[model samples]
Target: MLGAGAVLGLLAACSGGGSGAAPRPTSSGDGEIIVASGLDVTGSDGVRQQLIHAWNLTAEGRKHPARLLELPGGADEQRSQLLGALQSGSSQYDVVNLDGTWIPEFAEAGLITPLDPQVKADPDVIPSVAATARWKGHTYALPFNSDVGLLYYRPDYLKAAGFDPDSYPAAGMKWSGLQTMIRQLDTVHAEGALPGYQRGWTSQLAAYEGLTVNTIEAFASAGVHLTDPDGHYTADPAQLKTGLDELRDRAGSEYTLRGALSSYEAQSLSDFTAGRTAFLRHWPYAYRLLPQSLGAGQWAVAPLPGDAVLGGQDLAVSAASPRAAYALELAKFLTDPKSESCLLQAGFAATRDSAYRTPPPACPYVSPPAGSSPSASPSASSGETSTMPRDGQNRPLYASGTLRTALTSAVQRPRTPYYGAFTQALQSVVHGWLADPDPPDTDQVARRLDTALRRALAGR
Candidate 1:
């Protein structure tokens, strides 16, 4: 079972028509299992490639070696490529790495096959993460890695502003408290106490899926759910107004960096690392990369205020694959407890609880010799080793505590079969309003959004 608010919204019109015909089985059994996935953010020779290589050395893999096919472009572009390939039956993708939101869409369209029942009953998977693998009472994918938004802050800046960094809340604080700290940091910046300080915080607010995610976080914080659990348009003018007000306040010009208007993950991370903002709203991966730029004790991380969105990819066997059996085994091997521990060490939010609680043995896949520099290590990202402080148990110091707390309570974006349409409608309306110098009244915006959403959900 998933935590409260962990499950995605219900059914909607399916996106991209499928052939509805079963893929022809292949007679040749010697071909490699090709895995199609989005860019490996872990840099070249990433942890994923390492794990796959490890599997290839196994007795089973010697007969059927797997090759990783990294897709180019952002999430949207990758989705289109996958859908087109799967629909046309042109590509030989035995396994596909899909964003959690795409589970309903792929499952409803029969692009991916249901996973084994044993995988569905695996209790080691996080409750919220396990829920993402299922849609309409069947499991279509297995949780690979999990994601949740986290607040990355410059503790050095807080100290310079006469605040005790040690006194900061570890459990989490409300948005109002964060605002007060931001104001103090601003005052200090004005006095030339902090260099390159432009504003309180920055986040991904571009007119893409990032904007949709940010908007949903604001709406959830205000207790405004735009859609019912069944994915029906259920928001009223008042509810929308409340949600919009919260978004506007948090993202107001006075509090946020102007560059955030066109920023995505890379841009936001750059801004934060450049010392342009004291606070940043980003995913868990940033935790590893940030240490590359900011030295030890210079910054810290905590759970984001209000609700954070759940993210991460799931591994699914392509329905058209002749090597479905091998693909299934690969998925299981990649998400097994040992692999998950390796992911955690590499800075991903592991889906298994054991990765956090249990002491990890050396990553069997890629182990560097003792006392090697980051550049000398195979797991290093962009030639930089992670300086993320770890506990005595070898887990990230924040992993079992702060990070786990956030994941347990994180919320999901609307879970509709037509998620592409739903996100497009939401981002278009929201970004338009945010971009306006003199936006219309909340009621007018609300009406426009509601109508647009209804049309999108209804597949009009």
Candidate 2:
């Protein structure tokens, strides 16, 4: 993955060359519409692939077959590839699956076309998630799925530390209360009650977008918004200092797993699953993946302490596509209400309100085995048997209650045409402070960060 500074430089160069008008649409000889996206985290032949297969069976789909071309790498790599392809007209992507943070950049650059007003006004779309599809007051995409950080913990570990697992209120937990639990767990570890217990918690703190995300969550929890809704820099040195203090406490050596300093999502998850930490801060997808490793009663998930960050991808029609109308139809079909419900059952966080509140009809693509109950063990696509508990509706037991609440209240990262530059500057400064053995005074670091952000937002 590209480091923050390198990504910033690339974005600066791209923005310096002003964005021209979109290319005129032309008819294509071939009938295929290409959809470019990051790897489906649900594993090979995931729900996303299955959805495309379902679309192919429709009359409209049969005429214009939609093909998914997955970009291989982390989020930053995928962003770079999309930017290069769209800007240079090198690849003919009819539809693009974009991360929420990239919407403003893509929209303002004229790389994507605006969608109909109905997409923005759709009552079934979650309000917070729908907001991500718009840039400068115009809807440029439709949300395919939503994501939010959640706290996953080993109930067995909590019980070993002399805490009542049933009485623990993870949903309403605060930072102070979490610290208290960490102290107790530390003591228990010294007594050899918990083997391989390195620390209280683990999270993604590597010097990439993960570092930017972790920093934003800490700032949000401290009641700080670094940038205004218009994408202007808003924080002063004092506000930055306050937020930095909270982050320092959370990442302190005595409380956090040491590996977190260089850990990304995969590493942190591996550490947690290997019993290196009692608590883990991860995305909603972890709920499905964990069942493959941990048994039913071994773990549970709840909203993260304080604010969680919103993460997901939205589907946009390429402005230069020859088949723009058909691309739009395919995007809508993949994000419709039934599709959203199937996504929820397959472990991706569904973006529609109805997907959580109403009992859905049978998913059109997959069916349960004969004589199987509604709450069957297998997921909608993956053939493996899932140990994760489900409710009567066949949704994850915590889906309607715990997961829905988190998505409703999750905070978004800064929205800007220069988000690549913004996140790069953030990760550079924050990671430097966190990695230093003897860091500088909080106020000094805050001023440094404030200066960096101001220049970044100005397209410097």
Candidate 3:
């Protein structure tokens, strides 16, 4: 029930810090927690705008507050900007917020400090965020707001396809099952009673982080291996082909529609909410906005298919910061339920397990009826009917916690120093996959991706 404005007010209060003498070049500096965040602030959905407001509200309650520097827009741009600022001779940023996936790159590059000491030392932190904060053998960042890919469904069209409103997928869990639904929905659309049946699924397939996340989830769900346990790219031709084939098939299927890949955040939401798409795969942050964005009775969330590859932001002190202990304290506090709730209330998903269990009133996405029970089962939920009984989207995985784990283990997309190149390669393939079925050379695409993954892993 917390509006965006209220959350912004809260962030502003939480970021109060005295502007004393700026610190020197060394990590050991004077008293100041110069926190720099790269959250979008100017846009309507800007997280930083809300964070600044929330920080302002929490400032009165904090024993010690930090000065927040709102990094400018552009995820990739902010990375370079913050890095330059932090590495500058007179850098003042004590705690740096980083993209969760980039933690490995940053940690290995020594751009961020190891968090093992803080993890070992801090007891009040959330377990999930704590676990992700550490990279390699040590912790590198404290996960701030966690996001996961969730499957969105419309109960209306799905039921029209003769999908069991209750046991949507109890009979089969294969992508083939969803394919049947999409094909039927397409038929129904042609009949004109339903809007021309579009693909049942929508996702960010453009060459961006959302594309990476969506493609990886499909690969993982299909049981593909892009890497080994030691984080090596598996060049196994069969495995690589299998992954690419599944991605291509999903793209070809009737239900999986090509969304506005260029701008995932705004465009995909528009497509799904406008009823142009039947199902959407996106992060949880969309849940709060979708109701308003899509209108009532238009949208609802089910547990993401197969599982989700959870992604999020992390808070870590720069290895170069002198206020390591204080920064860690602030990290621990911000992740605490009270502070996390403020962010959640404002529309961010909390990374803490505790926040998941006992969400503050502000967070609308936290209470999915499954509560915090880790082993919650989606189909096993007591016979509670969906609000829209006609929609045939996947059965709500509201309580199913195992589905999330299944997704995380399926694939860890090829990580590399030139992630930009690897992602570009993926963009090429995704475009080919979505084009009219010419049966593009799957083998060639696989080889190209395999080579790219290998090069990235090898740091070439």
Global lDDT of each model? 0.79, 0.82, 0.57
lDDT of 3 by residue, 62-87 (tens): 43346667677666677778767656
- In model 2, the runs with Cα more than 4 Å from the true position are 1-30, 118-120, 364-383
Which lDDT value does model 1 have at 65?
86
User: Model 2 — TM-score against the truth?
Assistant: 0.91
In candidate 2, the residue pairs with backbone N, CA or C atoms under 3 Å apart (3 or more residues apart, or in different chains) clash, namely none
Clash tally, candidates in order: 1, 0, 38
TM-scores of the candidates in the order shown: 0.90, 0.91, 0.76
Question: What is the Å distance of residue 84 in model 3 from its true position?
Answer: 3.9
Which ranges of candidate 3 are over 4 A from the true structure? 1-32, 40-64, 87-90, 121-129, 164-166, 169-172, 258-263, 359-421, 428-439
Worst 10 residues of 1 by lDDT: 8-17
RMSD of each: 8.4, 8.8, 8.3
Which is the winner by TM-score between candidate 2 and candidate 3?
A: 2
